[model samples]
Target: YTSALHFLNTKIGKGQIFLKFDTVEHDAEKRLLAYVYMKNKTFINAHLLKHGLAQVDTTYPCKHLAKFTNLWKAARTNRNDAEKE
Candidate 1:
């Protein structure tokens, strides 16, 4: 987990990040659904999902929920196929 975080931080660099909050509450335990955009060019969340580094939380409501689900499923399928070989 630490290594993953480090890798993410490196990728983020000093670029501007935009966070779209899904909720108003600032509780630490609550997971806020937000898409992290870097320099208005990359969708960080989708990249993470596609690389199998993140999982889709179906309980949350988001505009990109379906896209995230599909990316997750494809990543899992690819991983499974690779393992079988």
Candidate 2:
């Protein structure tokens, strides 16, 4: 969580941020869950997954589920390989 927060901080002021909503806009408690993108079209969700800083939540279906799951798998594999070294 801290790592994700720090990385997001670095993105601050780089450009305008945009949110991409899926089927559900928010959870039961009114917390938002959306894909964040930068003005230049940088995908923050994939970035976090690629860096092993975020986990893929498969509880709900989303458009990027397959892509996110793939990225998360690759990141986990990379981390495991690095640890084996």
Candidate 3:
């Protein structure tokens, strides 16, 4: 089990992982989604569903979704959109 855990930890520890989530529902599910981070761009998709990991709200937590979202809203979007036009 330790080896598997080690493998999991190493697999998802290499990317700019982010977690934005909502209120946890089930205890078991919460245990799974409580910790989520990326080890790499490809692997670690499952770590976000495991214990001792980075847990984030998968959905908007309130009525104002944007305000509670991790959605990227930087000026870079404006520049890119302008460049396209």
Candidate 4:
């Protein structure tokens, strides 16, 4: 997680990032889900997912559930493919 966060920080590199919270209410743990968008309009969550650095928590409902699900599947597939290679 630390290495992944460091990679994100290097990529962000003084650039501005905008966090857009999901419209759904916070979970029981009071954790608010959000999407991190870079200045260039890139979705940071997608990047993390693609790199296999993040996972989808289907237990909680969110606006990006479908997207996250797809991302998670793709990440798994990519990891498997790389391992096979």
Candidate 5:
């Protein structure tokens, strides 16, 4: 969690960010769940998944859920392969 927070802080440091909300605005806990994007058009969500800093949540359907899931799977595979080396 600390690593993820640090990664996010570095990515979001003093830079303009954007959020895109899906059909729904908030989650069950009233937390604002949206797709985060960096100024240079970098998809933060995908990056987090690719780096194994975050897990893909499929509970709520979203356009990028599939892509995020694939990235997460690839990250896991890469990590496992590295561990076997």
Candidate 6:
């Protein structure tokens, strides 16, 4: 089972990419998966990540999936703000 996941969404030359990995089981099919998405390359995930791949720009599982919800709100707000401007 994947302990953590990584992803990013931003404008201007998205950095990073999704990488496959194995979990504690160390099985072929059930390899751990990690994706990076940032220029800083501050990769984030259950396990340590490699260079180039970036984290999701959020705290690990903040409040249990909280990061996702927070990101969603931030995206919505950004969209609204962009329209206004």
- 10 residues in a row with least lDDT, candidate 3: 47-56
Q: Model 6, which residues run further than 4 Å from truth?
A: 1-41, 44-64
Candidate 5 segments whose C-alpha is farther than 4 A from its true place: none
lDDT (tens digit, per residue) of candidate 1 on 1-85: 6655775888897778888665442335765657788886688888888888888876655778889999999999999999999
What is each predicted model's overall lDDT from 0 to 1? Answer: 0.79, 0.90, 0.41, 0.83, 0.90, 0.39
Evaluate model 4: give its TM-score: 0.81
Of 3 and 6, the candidate ranking higher by TM-score = 6
In angstroms, the error of model 2 at 53 is: 0.6
- The C-alpha stretches of model 1 lying farther than 4 A from their native spots are 23-28
Q: What digit string (tens of lDDT, one per residue) describes model 6 on residues 1-85? A: 1322232233223555544332332334654434433454443442222222323333222332444445555656666788899
Clashes of each: 0, 0, 16, 0, 0, 6
**Which 10 residues in a row give candidate 2 its minimum summed lDDT?**
7-16
Give the TM-scores of the predictions, in the order they appear: 0.78, 0.90, 0.27, 0.81, 0.94, 0.31
What are the per-residue Cα lDDT tens digits for candidate 4 across 49-73?
8778888877756788788788889
TM-score of model number 3: 0.27
Better of 2 and 3 by TM-score: 2
Models, CA RMSD each: 2.4, 1.4, 11.3, 1.8, 0.9, 10.4
Report the C-alpha lDDT of model 3 over 2-85, residue by residue, as the tens digit. 655676656644436655443553354345332234534432433322332322354523332343232223334544677899
Q: Is candidate 4 or candidate 6 better by TM-score?
A: 4
